[model samples]
Target: MSRGPVDPRLLQLSGPTRRWTAVLAVVTALRTVALVISGIIVGRTSASVITDGTGLADHRAALGVLALLVVARTALAWVEQRYSHRAAAQATEDLRVRALTVLAHRDPRTVDRAEWRTLLTEGTEGLGPYLTGYLPALMSTALATPAVLLVVWFLDAGSAIVAVVTLPLIPVFMWLVGTLTAGRTEKKLMTLGVLSDQLLDLVTGLPTLRALGRLSAPVAEVRRLSDRHRRSTVEVLRIAFLSSMVLEFLATLSIALVAVGIGFRLLDGSMTLAAGLTVLIIIPEVYNPVRQVGTRFHDARDGIVAVDRILTLLTARSDGDTTAHPGTTGEAGGRVSEERDAQDGQGGQGLTVTFDHLSATGRDGPRPRDVTGTARPGQLTVLTGPNGAGKTTALLALLGIATDGVTGTARVTAGPGTGPRLTGTELWDRTSYLPQRPVLDTADATAVGDTSGLSLGQRQRAAVHAELDRSRTTGRDLLLLDEPTAHLDTPNARTMVEALRRRAAEGATVLIASHDPLVTAAADHHIEVRP
Candidate 1:
């Protein structure tokens, strides 16, 4: 799977935003025209005032036109600012949605939650400068630069020539600075991601750290990481400042040269005062867009890098095979078999899950390998395994939750002709899953009897009870519980298992991954997974 180029991918995702940006560009061009007209009126009026004692009353019409143009320019500038921000916001929203969709579909273990939070929040928002500042300036340069150059040319060809020749120098200097700082910018972004991850990890595990008497242990480590990130940020900023300095210097030098040429031509009586003044006024406008691009480039770099990361994730395929059938394990480009198996019965009382050559690879550890099993409805199927044996992975794979590094055939044999295999949507619709470490929101915390006041075990038990109640009301077809009894005491754990058993008796397919002897003892079918 090819990720392709970032700009095209962004454009494809944000069609409406691009249209808005184009509209913004047109408004910007109009604003530039107003500025040029105002400059021309000012130049001609000044020349008139100098040439004739009665020029003030004689040039009253031009002064009025200048005033109106100023008002129009101000109004256009306001609209441009508003529309540019709106466009940037809309584009960022699109990127966030796409990135989130990819995250939701991919295997959870493969994703770094903290980094994802940073990417979706701070990283996506970083695009504001790119869209609102950089893109607008780029479009303005494309539209305004040439128009201004032509106006200057008509007034004085020599000044126009100097403007044209020097305009390219700003972009050239920008390119040089960008080339030199690209690596540092990337490193700075990476450091930020790491810092975000570490801070999030520390916050999430604060309770555990406190309980283990190591609450303050990570403080020094965090400080060190923070300092490193600070240094990286400063380095990137320093480069940005240097780039801006170079662009400003080049633009200023070019404008000064044009000013000098126009002054000399005026002194030699080769150019009219009005024409010289107009060329002098418009020269700086020619270089303004290019210089703006260089300044905004600093802010846009992070967003660009984030887009690349997002594209990489979007293009990645699951480990099994890209072309394999949804429920089967096969090589890439393999076709889904059309032949129906004998087990492809019509809609029945319950679903039967079958796994053939079931296995999954882990990011940093070993996983279950080649494990074959069947889990029938109306029974408790307990997966017993040592730690890191992929018990949770197996359950997740059956629900199509984490299929990235999984290679297996997991068929949920239910209703109709070829056995209605479960898609991710169907699985989510029919199943109630309880993860080992659930992050509770406000409602969940309240249901769990104020999580802040409860012990971990009490909170877990309350959460389970709440979920069980929901399952009963919704009548979910399947229940996937990972380490359901992990935080509970023996008696509480037994009671929880009994409650689960009741759910299974009510015709829900219940699968649990546990290491507890009590849970395995109550299972209707027990399967042990080995590393």
Candidate 2:
């Protein structure tokens, strides 16, 4: 249960982030070499000043080299910052797209829309500081810290011993303090989610609240949530500041131990002045990366939480999953995915899907209970039922999603010469499902941006055409549509009905989940379910 400071899942998710992190590690290693060189230059210069009484003029070459190293280090740091930020932005965008894709396919009843807004926007933004700040610091700590320690050990064994003795304290303290911050960070994120959800509800439901005379209720609740959010933020900041202080104190104390010991060794003539100075100059380098990591950990905690949220979403079970459903038959996991045989052409025969006692419970109640029917090629099977009777649910079941509360069995068998069954996802593999929400406004809707001017009926008509056209092109044997003509006029509806029948006659399984009289009347076979 104890995860590393960096989540491996994040690196796996964003290739850009991973690539940038590798770049950062390489840059940090170069910086480490530069740091050691600078330390040696300064130390030898000091030794010349004390032992041989040389002035600044005597070390001109060393000074020049130091200046060049400084410039190189500065440029490297700049590159690290620039690329790290760009990588963070790319990483955030990629992760956001991924989260959206998964959430979009998921059942609306299973996922919260308000939560999606937060996860996609605010939650993802948290990754910016994490990628740019904490991730680089982490790489630096992993690479630079060890390189410096090795250089110090090679230079002076006694100083190396001192470093070895005190080095463990920094991580020890970091671990203890980090434990405190981790809980605080999680609590803060939860409080923020609550606050965001409440504000979104208040804004969206303002009119409803006013009409119901309950505006004051949520106003008061918002105030309460705001207070909770404020307190959580303050607590997180307090823990962050305290952890930074603790880490800095440990680092400073560790450096003091090494430096003081070197100074004493120099005075006692047990160590050369050059070696002592070198050890003194290089000692802080050992602690710097660790110190930076400690401070950046707080900045990255929000991103870590966002990663957790995204992974959860990615792993959530699809509602009414056919593979997991006891009532459903066929191989598990195939209900969601399958590749139809490439041999099927657009003119190929339709596939048949048979349902027997197929039923499932919706969020509101049970629906499509005990429905039995067979949809054959060259026929339109219209499953008509009242609202809340699971017409949509039945379609989803056939598609092999949302396994919970699902019972009975649905199977897909190929029509004559439809080729191999698309069983990887089983029935869903060969099906094109048009959900009820997004109706297209034109066959070429992509050319018509800003559809705010288009009416629902226009969009609905366009959507039906688009879906049917897509199915035609893809040669999908099974087409599932939820209320395809819900927004069409009588003339349009009749045309859509004739089109459905025509498509069926051409050898495709057409199943319509609708209550429209036009659709029901055109049905070659009808199955009606009651609540």
Candidate 3:
């Protein structure tokens, strides 16, 4: 897929990072100013300790000054942390919402199991560390380091010069390690995705594999993928550990050099005892953020890469067609205006679909073909096809999936004014697909305010009834069902069939695709597939 403009995720990052950086910068500057005041107090107190030696009045005053500075710095640091976390959390939430929106618009059939699994598992999982750990580290390096260095320069020019010269080396080394392992890290991630994909495929298809005596084949392939993933992981870990060690050594050596310099100056009386102790305490503070930056660099790199992959997934071409709003005209093609006008004229009656020469396949193999059909307004027409037939595909094609590459002359009767055809947004507005295995997530169910302990059949029936009730307010009515009696045994299937018949009698178009003999026998209208 060709990428468009800048990634939205990257654009979203800019605002939050700016807010967090500003807050952290203020905190760092305040802390540095406090340190300066504290240093002056320390100097004056030291002089009093030497001259007065045992005056209770002098000791008490010094203690009061020192205590105030400590409390102020502590409070500011706490506020900084609280806001930083809030920024991180909000950014992560935005990314998650954008990801879901992208997924919702995607062509369902175009997404393979591996891609879906990667998005669900690795993609979302990367966001937490990226925001909380990596994002703040990046901001701290760019913001806090400079502020700390400025303070150090004011206090001791020599120490400031050393820090300025050495800090760049840490990032340089970090970049080198990152560059060397870039290819390997990507390869490792790819292998891990493949490993997860293989394992999942095996798990979902286990029953079929056992039935067909092909379990060993998939099991062997899964082992191979797992071993490859394990080897790649080991290589990545080895490089990461070595890089961390090198970075640690360099940063420690840099701080040690500053400490050595201050000690030498203190011995020669070039620096006062108060200044020496302050420099000793402040040197580590200057380098501490930089040290943290190095540690979190790996996480940051991985997260950015993961984000890039997510953007690619999100922006991939969808099977859905472009929508034309009422009374709007521009670039949709010839006869588009007429179609919109037709839909407008027919307020009660919405999109009408006619299928010709439709054929589809499951994951296993190609299904039967030549499914000709039409769905009229205010009429329920149930679709029936044999096992391994293209019934589901025919319905999906009507809804604009499995047929994005084709253009057709299929007419959509939108009220009295006939339109060009139904595709994309037009098809979507008139359609709602219920798959054979309607996924019932506990979370999704709660989200829509449907929280009854209902079985699959009961849940679906209630859901369909609720939709029907809502549609009754408007004059448009239609419902599509795939294997409505899939989970029901013989007796229950009969009851559901009678219920569907009643819905059809109430003037709602209910299309059902089922392989059960009971469903085929009970359907008011049937389209059979012969192999």
Cα-based lDDT for every prediction:
0.75, 0.76, 0.61
Q: Tell me the spans in candidate 3 whose CA falls farther than 4 Å from its real position.
A: 1-8, 11-65, 76-90, 206-221, 266-273, 300-302, 312-339, 343-345, 356-372, 378-394, 401-403, 409-411, 416-430, 440-476, 513-531
* Order of candidate numbers by lDDT, starting with the best: 2, 1, 3
**How well is each residue in 1-531 modelled by candidate 3, as lDDT tens digits?**
112212444554446655665676677667767766676576556755665685547578677877899999899878866776787666556655766555544335555656545644664555556556665565556666676677677777888888888878888887788777677767766787788877777788898989999878876777788888788768867887888898888888999998888878878888766666666666766676667766775665555566676655544423323322222221122122323423344445544555554554445554445566666544546666666566665555554434433223223455422553443344445555567766555544654566566666766655554545445654434567777778677787787777767766765666777777787776666655433
TM-score of each: 0.86, 0.81, 0.76
Across 87-108, the per-residue lDDT of candidate 2 in tens digits comes to: 9889988888877776655544
| Winning candidate number (lDDT) | 2
Worst 10 residues of 3 by lDDT: 326-335
Per-residue lDDT of candidate 1, residues 317-377 (tens digit): 3323232222332211112332334343333346667767777777664477776777788
All predictions: root-mean-square deviation over Cα?
Answer: 4.2, 4.7, 5.5
The better-scoring model by lDDT among 2 and 3 is 2
What stretches of model 1 exceed 4 Å from their correct place?
A: 1-6, 112-115, 315-348, 363-366, 415-420, 423-428, 438-475, 487-495
Q: Single out the weakest 10-residue window by summed lDDT for candidate 1.
A: 329-338
